[model samples]
Structures are given as C-alpha cells and as structure tokens.
Target: MKKRLPLIFTSVLSLSVLLAGCGTTAKTGSTATPTTQATAAATTAATPAPKKDAEPFTVSLRHIQIGDAQKFRKAILDDVVKKTEGEIPGLKFELDGVEDQVNRFTKLPAEMAANNPPKIFDLFGGTGDALKFAKAGRLLDLTPIITELGIKDKFVNLSQFSLDGKVYGLPIGGSSEGFYYNVPMFEKYGIKPPTTWDELTAAAETLKKNGITPIAMGSKGAWVPNMLVNTLMGRYAGPDIVNQIPAGTKKWSDPEVVAALTTFQDWEKKGYFTKGELGLEYPDMLNQFVTGKAGMMFDGSWRSSVFKDPAQAKDLTNKVSYIALPGVANGKGDQTAINGNYSNGYGFSSSLKDNELKAVKAFIKNLYNEDMQVRGLLEDNLLPSMKLSDAAVGKVTDPIVKQVLESYKKAGSVFSHFDSTVPSDVYKETESQLQKLIAGKATPQEMADAIQKVQDAAIAKK
Candidate 1:
C-alpha cells in the first residue's frame, strides 16, 4: 500500500579508472642518469591503479521515498550504499527514486516487458505486483539464497512473495491496520478499548454524548474509508475468505459480506465519524485524531511515524495505542487476523545470475540486520520483515510502536488489502462504490452486485 510509483529509467552507469601512462620518457641521445630508480618510483606513484577486468556491475534500484520513508532510506538504504563503499569491488548502485506512487503499479511492468528490468527494484508484495512478475518469469527466484541467508525463518508472510516452492522477493517493510485511539481521551471518558460490536457502539455513543468525534475519517480519496470497511469485512468473513472470491467460490453478495457493509452503514447512521467526511482530506482526518479531537482513527501502521513526531502530535507521547476493530456478534473471521501483509519490497530482476547474484545476496544480508530493524521500528514506523531478537525487541523505544509490533506478533494471521491483489478495474470500482455506500447513495446489495459484475467479467476474460 505504501509503495509509490515513479518515472521509469534504466540504471546503467559504468565507471572504470582512466589508465595513466607511465611517466618514464626515454631520451634518444641524452640520458638522465639512465632513468634513475627514484624517477621510476615517482612515475609509479603518479600512475592510477589498474582497472578491474570485470565491468562494474550496476544493481539498479527503484523505490519511492516519500514522507518518513526518506528517513528510512537515509538511515538504511543510503547507509547501505555508504557502508559498502569500496567494500565490494566493482559493485555499484543506481537507486532511482520516485516521489509518489503514480506509475509503480501500471508502468513498472512495461519496463519488464521490454526485457530491460532493473537488476533490483521495488515490488509490492501481493498477487497483483510481485506474484505477477514472478509468474511472468521476470523476477529472480531467491530460493537458493533464501535458505542460505536464513531469511526464510527471519521473515513473516514470506509466502505472499513466493510462488510454488520458491521465493521471489522480501518485504523489508510490513504494515497492518487497526484503530489508533487516543489513550488520554479514552481514560478521560471512562471508556475502554472495545473488543466486541456492542462495546464499540456503546463507546461511540459515550464519546458522542461528550461532544467528541468518535472516529476521524475522510473519504475524498475513497481508500481511507475502504481500508476500514475491509477491516470490517475481515471481521465478518474469515481472514482468508476473500481468496474464495478469486476462486469463484464466493460472491460479494454473500450474506456475511453484506452484513459487514451493513455494519459500516449502521455505524455511519449512528454518527460515529466526523461530519462532512466525504469532503475532508485524509491528512486532515489523521491530523484530527492525532491532535485529540476524535477518539480514534482506523488507519494503517504507517501512521506511527506521524504520531511519533512531537511537533505533529504533542498529546501523543505514550498516549496512543493500536488495537484491532471489534469483532462482530456472530462473525466467522479470526478476530486477531486484521488487515495486513508484507505490502512492498525489493525483488531481483531475472537477469542477475551466478556470481552477480552473490553480490546481491551479500547486500541484502547486510541490509536487513539488527540496526535496520531498529530504525524501521522506532524512527520510520515500519515493521521489519525479519524477527527481532528479545534484546533487539527490547530496544524498540516508542511505546505506541512497541504495542503495534506486539499486536503483529500475536495476530493469528493477516490478509492482503482487498484492492491490492485484485485487478485494477475491479479495485477502482470497489473503492468508488464504497464511497457511495457510505454516502447512502448505494445499498450494500447494489454495491455487491456491481462488484460481482466486474469480477465475473474479469474471470470470463481470463
């Protein structure tokens, strides 16, 4: 979800030292002490070192460094480049950064289609992006090195980035979604973090009576609201239920799915969210929650960095906590299985092979160690794909992020964001109709029917 697309450019910079000619000049008649040994040594001292016979290998990298992701790159990616300076002979990096996520999903594949993919590039870790590349034979199979680096055991949800029995990539960063609540507000209102449908309603009612907005949300982007709605769907249907839709075993019209949408509708009817939400921007919604105007905001784990900023949220030192949205009265989904996945990461291009692959592996090994894990968790609000040791986990300095990491560890399972792995048109339709559903312009049934039409069309074309 956080992966932003950028302009595509091939990273091909080949550098070799300019060979210097030996400074020794032979005279035809006059001999200058027969070119003394001191003169020869001086000539040698001025000569440049011989260039490597092997051409400089460029590991082309494409990533979007927006918001605190820039901090992560400076701390991790930039640091990797700095640390490996002269460490690996003939190794070079071309980190092509995109400022936003505009072309990453659509345009990246075109680069791959041309048979000139980056040696290592950013890939969203879902069936939609990473899996598509793997299925097309565009990505390098990391199976041999996955075990060699012990990355298999260190990471969670590696299967999402794997196909068949081979791994294709690794998500350096992971994400999850839940209600980010104001601790002091909850305590001041004598309210508790809810764990069931009725409790959540009661809490919302209590907050409403006190003139506090129960939830902070904006629908201008459509995605902000749908993310929460997806979380509700996960609560009603099982964690893996969405897979059935792609498999043609379930319809969006199924009662369980409809019930989830109905639940969201009920919440809207009850004044649980900020008024005029459809027009409000997502940043404004988060700002409201962070500044303590609302009881909570259903948002991604990526927001941890914002909350961690003292200038952004002065009230939130240790006053924010993350928890899953309450389970439904008769829900089938695993309550612990909230919305999450290894949403984005780096994958090797298929062209890197044999000895070249060795440098890639070494760089990755050096990249995902304990120091990067600390920065990812504490500074950048990212969860490391690798498991942290007890000592390293203890070093996580932010209480709110520590809480999120603990939730991540205790969760039963995770599902990819619904729109992420689905086809582009279907995702757009679902997001648009969801905005309408919350606006009362579309019924849950209408929305489901509309989505099913798109789904069926996609399936037929396939």
Candidate 2:
C-alpha cells in the first residue's frame, strides 16, 4: 500500500493583544496665574496620549512542543508568544499543541485539504509538506516577508522551504542524528565511545550480556526507529542516495539500501534494541536511557536539552554524551558524512485577513531574530537555522552541545534525512515497511522493493 502525506503546513508563531485608550479633557478658559498655567501646560505635554481601542482577534497556531521532553522548547515559544502579542494590538493567539507525529501526519493534512488550515501552524519542508501545500496554493508565500525583515541571507539553507523563486516555511533550527550514551554506564562497563563498526557492536554485545538494553528505541511511531535506519542507509548506500531515489537515478531496492535494512534487522534478531520497542512511544525511549535502563540511544541533537535540565532528566543530568555513529566496515561514499536536517518549521495560511497577516508578520519578527535563535541554542539545545556570529556560537558551554558541534565539525560531509528528500508516498512506505521488517513479517529485500515501487509510482505522477 502506498502512503500519502495529507498534512500540509506547520505554523511557527502566535500571539494575542488588545489595547484601549482613555483620556480626560481640560476646561476651556481656566482662570490661573501665568506660573500655574505654564506648569499645567508642561504636565499636559509630558503625558503620553492614550492608544486607540482595537478589536480583539485570534490567530490560530498549531505546535508540537508537547511533553516533558519538549518543555524547554515550549518555554522559548511561550516567551516569543508573549512578546509578539505585546507588539501586535488586539491580536490573540489560539495555540493548539499536538504531538509531533499527530500534527504532521493527521490534523494538519485534513485541515489543508479542507482549505481551512490555522492562520499559522507547524510545518515540515519537502515535496510532501510545504512544497505540496505551495503547489495547492494553500500556504502563504514568505519571500517578501523575509526580505523585508532583512533576514533573507541569514539562513544557512532555505532550499527545503523554497520552491522556484518563492519561500513558504521557515525552519526553526537545525539538528543532526547520532548516538547519545550514558557516560557513567559506559565507564562502568569499560566501554569507550566507538569509532568503528566493530567497536560499536562489541559495546552493544557487552551491554546486552550485562542485561542492559544496548540501544533504547521506540517504534510505535515508526519515525523513531527510522532515524537509525536512515543513518544506516546513508552509510551503506551513500548520502546521495536520498536525492537519487527521488530523481529516478536510483531505486530504494538497490542492494546497498536493502543491506542497510538488513543491518537493522540483524540488530533486532540479536536483541540489541529495547525489547517490545514496537509497542513503546518516543518518550519511553528517552525514559529508558535517562533512567539507566539502556546504555545508548540513537537520537537527534535536540535531545541534549533533556539531559541539561535536571527537572526532566533527573539523575541523568550531566551524565550523557553524544557522538556520531561510527564508520561501517563496508560503508561506501563519504563514510564520515552525518545526517543534518533543517526541514522542520512554521508556515502560515494564504487565506489570512489583513489583521491576521499583520499578526503573522509580527510573530515572525519576534520569533526568528537573533535573541530567540540564541535562546533556542542555549535553552533547548537546538542548533540555529540562521547564521550565528562567532561570538554567539562561542556562548555554548554545555558538554553535550559541544560534542554535537564537534561531531558536525569533524564530519566529512552532511546528508539530509530521506523523509525530507523523498516524496511522502515513498517516505511513508519506508516507515510502515520498517515496522514490518522489525516484526519479522517482511524481509529486508521485501521492504526495499515495496518502498521502491511506491517511489516509482510517485515519480511517474510527478
């Protein structure tokens, strides 16, 4: 079965504000001495005029900063909302928080199809998301806005959110996927951060023997497991394969791609992953690692925030370290290339009223500036999507965040996640087929073939 991405947009900012004015009149021809009249005139001149009353209005915003793991991100968003509302009179933001997957795969799509999406909402970039919505004329074109804001060149990359000459969404931050290990657990087991495939597997075997889940995983939302598989695909098939498949130069069923799936399947058979991962949610994976039930987890750099906050990570605070996945023995292409993504962000509806458009503009100005981007880096462990000065990047002191930056610096190259490279049909097939592969109901080759078929059909349509 082919999967379609119906979800259209992800909005980034929202706010509510209402301002009213009041004033008192002075009596005409008041009898007073010159000194008293002069004093009154000075007083009157010093008093600021009251503002005009504004009609209350709402700009509906959809977001994915939900759960304990997302509290830091939510805090940054809350502050932005307050500032935006303060600047935009009579504007009220109706925020709707949803799980990332639900908002991306369910609600947003339906609303988009109905041509009634929120004024602003969370969105992803790629053929399936921002691009698709742009084609349907459902998303607001932000090219002029960014230019007007004088931020057109500040972004590191806007390719994902741009189509031809117009821009649609704006990425909030950048992230790279890799291994986050329990520092104490590795020390206790006499394991060093692996620099090669053999060492990685050896460490996993050691942990499994010691009754620790080697890799914390949650597959209930297939996207969780797909993260590791995507990196693995990068290793075996090469980074370019992501773009190649969509461009018809390569197929998902290519042997190297199938081998990547087999690698994951082999891990499953050897009991390297959390037992019953298929039944667990994303948060469960984090809980397993932070609680010391697992020795390692393959996750994004954004997760470092959880370990930095004691309220969220508890005893695990300051006890976690991140590293790039080691080079595979037979890996092809630039083996040191790591997965980096700047595809997720917020977008706006094209059908906004004049006031709503003003509100959206104010939201963008408030949220995507230097201060907020720096706040995201310091508070949420999210890498800046826009360019930061050397002084700004120098502000990073967190050990885990440092490691993330180091890994990126050391990488030979960077590749994007396939979810952002391929069309929704093909990406969705990979997710479902991966679950089937994990359950032992489908062979790695079978999974690859299924994904390739979907890819072919999608390309034909294009």
Per-prediction CA RMSD (Å): 12.1, 14.3
Candidate 1 lDDT over 167-275, as tens digits, reads 8888887888888888888899899888767877888899999999999988887878988878888888877766877667887888888888888888899888888
Estimate every model's Cα lDDT from 0 to 1: 0.76, 0.90
For model 2, what is the C-alpha lDDT against the true structure? 0.90
Local distance difference test, candidate 1? 0.76
Best by TM-score: 2
lDDT of 2 by residue, 240-312 (tens): 9888989999888898998999999999999999999999999899999999999999999999999978887
Candidate 2 to native Cα RMSD, angstroms: 14.3
| TM-score of candidate 2 against the unseen true structure | 0.89
**How many clashes in each candidate?**
3, 13
